[model samples]
Target: MLEFKTTSPEETFAFGQCLAKVLSAGQVVCLVGDLGAGKTLLVQGMAAGLDIQDAINSPTFTILNVYEASFPVYHFDLYRLEDAAELYDIGFYEYTEGDGLSIIEWPDKFPDQLPDEYLWIEINSDFVNNGGKVNERVIRISALGTAYEHICEELKQICPFLP
Candidate 1:
């Protein structure tokens, strides 16, 4: 596991962009965060690093969004899903096994449906007890597969704040 801190949304996105530099086909990144915790921002940065020309946005309603880039990026937002069955109904398995970089948000909704070859990225916010409205964002990364472990090490070198 690796932990890093981001002071702002842009930093979060920058982190994503940095991670994107090392991404390739057959990569699955599971993003676990609060609603406004900058998960999408990180993905947008990843897209930028991947040379995705078009804008990248959250696919909460659409469930999935695909972008053309140096390598394909398949973004999925499963926030609305109630069960793994719903995900299966939408061909979630196919997406995970496809030849592209898969980035998923709200993966907890379909835990059983997720492949064992994914990297879990968890983001949490911490409040400063002695400060006046200041917060620290913690980003934790856990890689399950050998490929992901190597990719994550590469990503850490790119992200200066990685711990």
Candidate 2:
């Protein structure tokens, strides 16, 4: 696992921008975080890196949102899902196996349904200890595939804050 500490929301987003530099088609990124833990912030930065023009927002109510970029970004928010089977209703499997990049939020809701190999990111905050600064976050990135393993190494080089 690779770990990073972001003192502000911008830093967290910057991390995502950096991460996007290493991403490619048919890749899946699973974001696990608490409410307001900067998961969407990171994705927005990724949107910027991918040159997505539209505003990036959490797909909480919509289940999924697709954005234009070098390759399509299939963003999904599974927080509202009642069960893993509901994934089919939103074409989750198709997107995951398709030729686009997939970004999933609240993946813990259906851990078993996720592909065997994907990027898993965990973001946690220390608001209580940081005087309630909502932006303080520690992000952990892990690779479950051979390609992602190499990508993580590349990320460590470009991301100065990764430790």
Candidate 3:
């Protein structure tokens, strides 16, 4: 596992941009975080890193958004999904199993249905004594298979402070 800390949204986004530098086609990245945990912000930085000019928004209502980049980026938000079957209805497998890169938010909704090999990221925020947001986050990244393990190794090089 690899871990890093960010004190601001910009730092979180910068981490995502650094992460994107090591990603490639056919990769699936799973993001687990609470609401307002900066998942979308990180993805926005990834889009920028991929040279995508379109506005990157949370696909809460749309469920899926396809962006044109050097290859393709399939972004999915599963927050509203009540059943794993809904994934099939949205052609989730087709997009995820295709040649493009896949980034999924709220994948914990159907954890058992995820691909066998993928990148898993969990973002947790720090709160003040009064439970107010502090704009601080600890991002934990891990790999599920050999390919993803290599990716994690590459990430360590990109973010030397990761430990």
Candidate 4:
């Protein structure tokens, strides 16, 4: 597992960009975090790193957004999903299994449906009551399979400070 802390949104985004440098096709990244944990911001940085010029945003209502980079990027938001069955309607399996990169938000909602091998990213924010240090976030990343393990290893090289 790799863990790091970011004191501001820019740091988080830069971390994501560093992460994107090691990502390739057929990778699945599952994000777990609260409402304002900067998940989308990280994804935006990843998209930028992948050379995707289009705007990146959470597809809370649409469920999925496909962007074209060197390879396709399948971004999914399961927050609004009322049932796991809805995953079928949104072609979750298809996109995730395709030769593309998949990033999922709220993946904890249906953990059983996720691929056996994926990169799990959990973001925890330290919210101060007095509105001090509001942007502090602790991010933990772990790999579930060999491929993902390699990604984590690459991340360690790119982010030397990761513990």
Q: Sum up the clashes in candidate 1.
A: 0
Best by TM-score: 2
Between which residue pairs do clashes occur in model 3? none
Relative to the true structure, candidate 2 reaches a TM of 0.95
- The order by descending TM-score is 2, 4, 3, 1
Local error of candidate 2 at residue 104 (angstroms): 0.3
List clashing residue pairs in candidate 1. Answer: none
**What are the runs in model 3 whose C-alpha is more than 4 Å off?**
128-133, 160-163
Summed over model 2, clashes come to 0
Better of 2 and 3 by TM-score: 2
lDDT for 41 in candidate 1 is 83
Write the number of the candidate with greater lDDT, choosing between 1 and 3: 3
Measured with C-alpha atoms, the lDDT of residue 19 in candidate 3 is 88
lDDT of each: 0.85, 0.92, 0.91, 0.91
lDDT string, candidate 1, 23-138, tens digits? 88988999999877778888988888888988889999999999987667799999987767787777788878988889999988778788988899998876567653326678
How many clashes (backbone N, Cα, C below 3 Å) per candidate? 0, 0, 0, 0
Model 1 worst lDDT window (10 residues): 126-135
Stretches of candidate 2 off by over 4 Å are: 128-131
> What TM-score against the true fold does each predicted structure earn?
0.91, 0.95, 0.94, 0.95
Winner on TM-score (1 vs 3): 3
